[model samples]
Target: MSDAAPLRIPLRPLARILHAREKGENPDAIERENLRLRHEEMRDRARVRAEGRILVLGAVFTLAFLTIGVKMWMVAESEPAEPRTSFAGAGIVAQRGDIVDRQGRVLATNLDTYALYAHPHQMVEPERAAEELVEIFPDLDQERLLKDFTGSRRFVWIRRKISPEQRQAVHDMGEPGLLFGPREMRLYPNGAIAAHVLGGAGYGEEGVAAAEIKGTAGVERAFDDYLTDPANGGKPLELSLDLTVQAAAEEVLYGGMRLMNAKGATSILMDAHTGEIISLVSLPDFDPNDRPNPPTEGHPDDSPLFNRAVQGVYELGSTLKIFAAAQALDLGIVGTDTMVDIRGPIRWGRHTIKDFHWYGKELSVADIIIKSSNIGTARLAEGIGINLQKQFLANLGLFEATPVELSEAPSGAPLIQKNWSELTTMTVSFGHGMSISPLHLAAAYATIANDGKRVRPTLLRQTGPQDGPQVISAAAARQSQRLLRQVVTEGTASFADIDFYSIAGKTGTADKPKPTGGYYNDKTISTFASMFPAHDPQYVLIVTLDEAVETSGDEPRRTAGWTAVPVAAELVTRIGPLLGLRPEIAPVPLADITLTSN
Candidate 1:
């Protein structure tokens, strides 16, 4: 670098200074003036440098302000959102509680996974990404996926959830646009088991990082708020179902449905006293893990999602007969020994009531029930009078839907005749003229098994009896229990009577009514409402078969005794021990033993 040039200064002629000195005049003023000029030059240079530094600092400040202003504008124009997993201040809940059986077995739970989303503009290989994704999930259409990947969409959802393997597969494609959002999805570990009770869950709120899961039906839907409540601290919702019992029941029911060639079937095993359901099975069933959409074009029953036990109402046939006899006995209008005239075809206008078989001219009230004499039951209903009969049925909870903890419970409200004529009274005595769900029948039978205490059925585990309203005298309930025992031992339900287990119940076979007309002679809804050890009942099981026919005989028998009874017998044989209901009528043999401590 070159050095700065020296500042120009006016110089007095050396001659003049020298001449002044030589004339003996002092030249000190000339020397002092030169020194002052040099000082002035140094001050001017410092001022210019200071001004230059000030200007540079001002430019730097301006640039910083401009950069900040642009950034603020961009941020103001962008959309605002919160992270998906955090909904604390938001009204919606993000996490869901687990559902478990009474035995603490998980029925439904959550799985940590990733949600696949896309930023189309950031894609490096849109076609390859679409091809690979379609390969990973055949359900995806390649063309649609490719279009979505290459289109103007800045963000698009690829899949609601992806397994780790799938996420890795997509990650391997090296596409910058394909991204994963962390989320939890509903998972049913025991596939298709207790499908009806669990109902199902589906996605609610959607985001790239997280998603919301909400119950769509069944207990999941019934307890939606409770399951999602933050105050619950994620405690599992325990149900009345025993997983082992439920699995056994489903297997038996499914096999029975197939063997009987029935269209569908349902079974409910409930605690006679506590009203807690041990196992409720409805088949054909679906896996809640991948729930099917509700059918839009057929009968609701056509859908596997339909909960038959809680939703399907049928003329439960002679299961309703027990209610009449108990009511009559409770009212003191009859005794077990009282004789009832079982005359043929008791006429009531256009319709006539008759027993499935002739019981002669007269049969004792005990025999009336033992033989399942519909005529006798109808006569008892007539004697009970319409108002008292209605009151009695309502007290037994047959008039309303069960208060069971399920979303479908309310829809099971019994179908009652609007007119409720005398004929209606007679038919209803034998489980006709009114339609009720099998669950209702189970509860009614539970009343008898529970010694006449009207119980409100529930899906939650209970510690003891419901101790609901007393609908009938304990004596009447005992008498009814004896009659039901006699039915199994000596009448239509003889097929189910096991000497060791001591089964008791009534057989019901009702002709299915046609959509356009009265009834179909061939198609019948057969049911068996039974309790174990009639002498001292513990549980009431109601098993119903839809259009079941046992064809091993010369003719296709469609009675509950032929179909529902045998299935129930098998179930009792299988699950009775699980319920701690051992078949050994004899007491456990004692053995010699010694006590020791480790």
Candidate 2:
């Protein structure tokens, strides 16, 4: 309204002028619209991009959570591992095997037990704890316990092999530092029944000494390595011993020792065919459970722990005469019908060999064995010569120890070392001056019973073929058996003759030599070596007593017939039925097998 258009213009020019003005005024509006449209387009694209990112993140999180859950489940479903509970105490002894008798009876067994230990550092009121322990275990040393408790030790064994009641009492006390460890203890149930054979146990149920019972004597010492092996825990060891037969033998031996007022006695039974030791008994044996504690002043007689059957050696008198006679016959120097002059004593060097019963004239070999004539034996030995006698004795296993699962001294002295003069030979022929163990006598008689096959004796049950050397000819052994049978039937060992069972045996009574020099006439060793079912022998029994005195009121002198022979007879009577040997009389020989002097 204020300004007037100057010039007269065409319509087109005017419109153009108006359009230019409109374009100038509205330039900001067009730029604002373009900016708003561009902003709206960017917002839509950003929303889609944000939504896509959120979806991708959620998928990734879900996958990772699933993977972790699967892994966790897998880890939780596995099998559980075994707990470790091995022996980790001070000594750490592994468990051992079981010891069983012939009939599978448990002789020795291991029992699980608990031992109490203390961690002294963790203990509260150590002195009080010690006092409490002493109260529960009166035998425990209180002073020692207090000292051990107060000492600077991480661990200390309070007591071992604790009973269940003891363990419960300790736990109820709620004493800190107390710990329990599982242990095994060896136990002998039969007590003293077969103590000598089974032996005893040590602390923690281990085998430890000798007849001293520390794994020192008998089968305990012999089989210690096997019994203690940790790999064979709970396995049983079988012996060839028959407990019934052993009890019978022990009864007889104990009776004889008591009857004769003998210092000590020993007896053994062996299978003649297999050489299995069925029974072995030595009087004055100790209980395996209450083994003597190193021979203190408390125990003096406990020194007899030595096994007499395998360890003791004695001058086995007339019993050896059978071997001498067999030697003469085997060497062809004498026969059953051979005759020898036995008028009086025969003098050789400083020693004079005398006959107990002097036959005024000549006597046959059969008469010699029946009468137990010393002069007749000397005559026969003289004919055989010393070398031949020595050789024959060696073959009979007299020169060496009988092979058994035991420690023993060898039989017979060194023949070469002993002065072998004519007097030595003569006296030895009648079973004097030469010494051997009871086991040796048993083995030799077994040879006679087995028809000359000298099978070695064994404690272990035989599982394989025989491995012993033959010793004598069948004919020679038969002759010896015949003579021995006659000795029991009509000679000195008549007491050993059983009514139902044919008996073959020899009687021996010799003076035990004094430590100084000659034999002690007052002290005598009596022995009886025997076999049953004489015609077909099965078992051999030997009984021996040292320093026997006759108190039976029958005989003043302690002879084999009175002491050892009676014991052998009793043993045979009791054990025969147990061994399945029927009491039937053996038939007489087809030919009269008699012994003759040489």
Candidate 1 lDDT: 0.88
Q: Listing every candidate in turn, what is its Cα RMSD in Å to the true structure after a full C-alpha superposition?
A: 10.6, 13.9
lDDT of 1 at 489: 82
Identify the leading candidate in terms of TM-score: 1
Candidate 2's C-alpha lDDT? Answer: 0.77
- What TM-score does candidate 1 reach? 0.83
lDDT of 1 by residue, 491-551 (tens): 8898897646888899899999887879998999999999986779998898999999999
Residue 102 in model 1: lDDT: 88
Tens-place lDDT per residue, model 2, 142-176, is: 89988888887787877766888999999987888
Q: Can you give the lDDT of residue 389 in candidate 1?
A: 92
